[model samples]
Target: MFKKISWKWYVGAIIFTVSLALIFPLVGLKSYVNEVAIISESLMIVFSYKLMIKRLSGPVTFFLGLLVGLFWGVALFSLVGVIYNIN
Candidate 1:
């Protein structure tokens, strides 16, 4: 299963992970961090849709990615809020 998946999908995920790691030090605001996390999650969702499932139309993939990204963003934002509150 998944033998034909493109290498680009894995490459994109690697890039996102690297960027997410590097971005932590530059983030001074929680809002910016949340934005970055959501964007990364959206990209990953796109990669997932392309890799693990049959191709979907652009709008379908976009909406699915946005939905998943927003869910992840809310969780991330809540964690961030907790950390800020603790400090």
Candidate 2:
């Protein structure tokens, strides 16, 4: 499923995750959380596009990974906002 995603997507994900876990704590939103979420969703699209390119050997797995990643991004932003009240 998601295996089609380029390593770049994971790189983006990791960067975003780390930013949320580390930088978001100190800087808070300042409107940055939305940017982070957008980037995360973009990464999901990248994953999906890669899957499409592969003709989707395993559509479910690929879609599920994209979905999970998208949701994870949303959830991450929500969590950061909760602790830091960036929302």
Candidate 3:
């Protein structure tokens, strides 16, 4: 099912989802940010796994991608929360 889709699409979708997760809390959806972040992160992990399974990415690439996503998402959320006093 994922073979026909270009890898670029996966990357784009993951970026979009993470962006949305970060944006929502700042836009007055603080209460729902947890849900959003969880879903977004899960989606990103799944996409990374798919890329690895397809041989479009290496195991190291997949691991680093998850690490990067985790740190980026948490850091952004913390910075935004601190700056905006959202939580």
Candidate 4:
């Protein structure tokens, strides 16, 4: 089953998930909005992890993508906090 999966699908999912993480902060400045985004990012992390588990090859690459997503999520939340502090 894992061999049947395409690399494009993995890449696309990662790209889309990370994009949302980066965009969420720019969409709103409210605390609730940020909380929602953080929740979504956490979900994305799980989603990506499941996908990685599905693949039989190159688990390291998929794990790295998961880490990147996690990092971006945390960084974006921090940025949102900074922006809120500035206002």
Top model number, lDDT: 3
In the range 1-87, model 4's lDDT, one tens digit per residue, is 544656566566656654554555566635455555566566555555656665645677567657856786777667656755524
Please give the CA lDDT of all the candidate structures: 0.58, 0.64, 0.68, 0.59
TM-score of 2: 0.52
Can you tell me which runs of candidate 1 are displaced by over 4 Å? 1-32, 52-58
lDDT of 4 at 34: 53
The sequence of per-residue lDDT tens digits that candidate 2 reaches over residues 1-87 is 656556775777767654765475586445565666666666665655554655546666567667766786777677767867764
Better of 1 and 3 by lDDT: 3
Better of 1 and 2 by lDDT: 2
Candidates' RMSD to native: 5.8, 4.9, 3.7, 5.7
Best by TM-score: 3
Tens digit of lDDT per residue, candidate 3, span 12-39? 8767766776677667777877676666
Q: After superposing candidate 3, which stretches have Cα over 4 Å from the reference?
A: 54-87
| Per-residue lDDT of model 1, residues 2-87, tens digit only | 34666676567646754653455356543466556666666566665565445777677667766766676666556655655523
Q: Model 3 misses residue 69 by how many Å? A: 7.3
- The candidate 4 region of ten consecutive residues with least summed lDDT is 29-38
Ranking according to TM-score, highest score first: 3, 2, 1, 4
